[model samples]
Target: MPTALKLTTVQGNSLPIPGVESWHVTAKDPAMLVMTDFHWHSSVTVSENSTIDAALDHMKHTGVRCAFVIDGKMSAVVGMITAYDISGEKPVQHMRLTSTPRNEILVKDIMQKMADWHVANLKDIESATVAEVLKVFTDSDVTHIPVMEKNANNEQRLRGLLSFAKVKRLLVA
Candidate 1:
């Protein structure tokens, strides 16, 4: 039978790891790695009330794959529309070909709700090693994860985004 081992965090917090010794000391932990800094791409935000057509135009202008849906001070990720989502069916072509204006289709009509999507906060992500993060990307259906920073008031604010492609590059490097 394989022997189990216990791991601890930098603060001597015990972590559960089966059949592994000093698991916290492994390369998977960010604390053990030399690279502590993580980079993020600028966030593309849109109002939940905005039309899908408008959102698409904004996405094209920004050249980003996803956009966060915001409503006043209460911001939550509504849904993410990727190039593939807009492509394949060629909605743009159909819109242009038809007389229907783009503004008619609201983002709420198309955006996936927060409850329906897989989301992770910075604190939840910070504990993960690069390999672990990569695993999340591979295992999950989502391609992008929004990174949030806690403000002085203890409110989570969307700071930036982490892309699976970028994480993959870092891992390979």
Candidate 2:
């Protein structure tokens, strides 16, 4: 048998901890308020072939309004899908156009293709303020903005994403 492990008992009922400093985000704050930085957080993703219902379920379970749709090999994002896309008129349009049943509709069928996405350069976003980001959101009437950066290979890679809902929740201006 191995040696017995030692366990320490509590020496006091209370421990001292530093108090958190409170701060409110303002329109002049860093654009990070509107962005989900991929470096610190994972993006919600779903297979392109997944049924719209399944994709919507995954988004609901993850508490995210948008997700990147990855291709079969899961090596590339071919499109984007949002809660609106899954629940909005896109589904009905696709069904009518393709004569497919609602249950058989796939994320790729209603998703906005990568080529159609309006994106922001990571470099531009790095220096942008919350107010500027909000302006882009309002002017473009877009709910999501995918941030891109060039990797060492000189190929553009998805870096982060900006969400209008997130910005609205954190915006003080």
Candidate 3:
């Protein structure tokens, strides 16, 4: 009061509160990270009968690590192909089982069979936290799960995908 009344001598007007040291969000943090295909997906696909070379080429062209395999002209997805499958000789191994040449291998050969593929429901995903999504990855062998959502007609259709790629990238970093 004496200093202020006599002269303009205020040292600091703001409280000594802590300021943000860094503003970065990582996957390991407990974030309410609800996500879907609409969040970060850019995609490409191949027919089940499409050649592995073609699938690989498609991946290369589109900068996608994976591609979905669709059934004959139907919008139904039959399987999926990933860079790991190609490099790990999975397609060649599948071809070997059927006595097919390596060059002739197709998406159907190495693709994760629809019966074996794991999937998630959009409704459940909507409320699931990032931790839960990470648990899904930790609890399953599948690297990705296609998400299905109910349409206006109440028919469930492919709407999104959750991949281990994000978890891998984050954890590794």
Candidate 4:
């Protein structure tokens, strides 16, 4: 008759291997998983000629929360402003749409200056892991991160944008 193999128990379960230790391994998805193959272009942009009211109107029409202030020269990415910046404090009755035109109020007049904003270049973003992105979101006040890339001419171009919402979803997923 064949001999029966002996079994060992741990926490009321039989061990797969007798006299060998068992371990539980936890795995995490890397930052690459969060990156999408199809880039979602952020069309929310305005020129220096654009007024606060016009920008706000454009934002409302497009359902975008923020607008990027752009100029033809070098794509400096001067600044960005949101609807909350305008309406957060002012009451609805006090908010002026028609009376206060956009041309009259240049984007620079209302945009949160670059000096006051936190900037993260594309290289910086590419090097940053999902955990680092989460740390940035938790540590900073800004919601959007501008992703910059170098063009064929070797000039920096604004490639895309990263939002806190996307980062959070990726981390949790």
Best by lDDT: 2
* lDDT of every model, 2 decimals: 0.61, 0.91, 0.72, 0.62
lDDT of 2 by residue, 1-173 (tens): 99999998979897666534434578998886568899889999999999999999999999999999999889989999999988889999998999999999999899989999999999999899999999999999689999999999999999999999888877775
- Candidate ordering by TM-score (highest first): 2, 3, 4, 1
Question: What TM-score does model 1 achieve against the real structure?
Answer: 0.55
Instruction: Give one digit per residue, the lDDT tens place, for model 4 in 52-163.
Output: 6777888899866677787757365777777765555332323364354434665566677666766566666666677776677789877766666777899866666656
lDDT for each residue of candidate 1 in 1-173, tens digit (9 for 90 to 100): 88799896576667668734432233365621312223433567787777776777888898766777776455555556554545434456556666555557556655656666565666766676777767777888767765666889998666556666555544533
- Against the true structure, what is each candidate's TM-score? 0.55, 0.85, 0.71, 0.57
CA lDDT, candidate 2, residue 150? 97
- What is the alpha-carbon lDDT of model 3 when measured against the actual structure? 0.72
Candidate 2 local lDDT, residue 135: 92
| Model 4 lowest lDDT segment of ten | 23-32
Better of 1 and 2 by lDDT: 2
RMSD of each: 13.8, 6.4, 10.8, 14.1
Candidate 3: tens digits of C-alpha lDDT, residues 1-173: 36555555658777555643423335455322433374365557888888888888888897667788889775777887887787786866777688888789877878887677787888887777566787888987777777878889999777777667754554422
Candidate 1 stretches with Cα past 4 Å from truth are: 1-42, 72-80, 88-103, 149-154, 169-173
C-alpha lDDT (0 to 100) for residue 161 of candidate 1: 64
- Screening candidate 4 with a backbone cut-off below 3 angstroms (N, C-alpha, C), the clashing residue pairs are 51-102
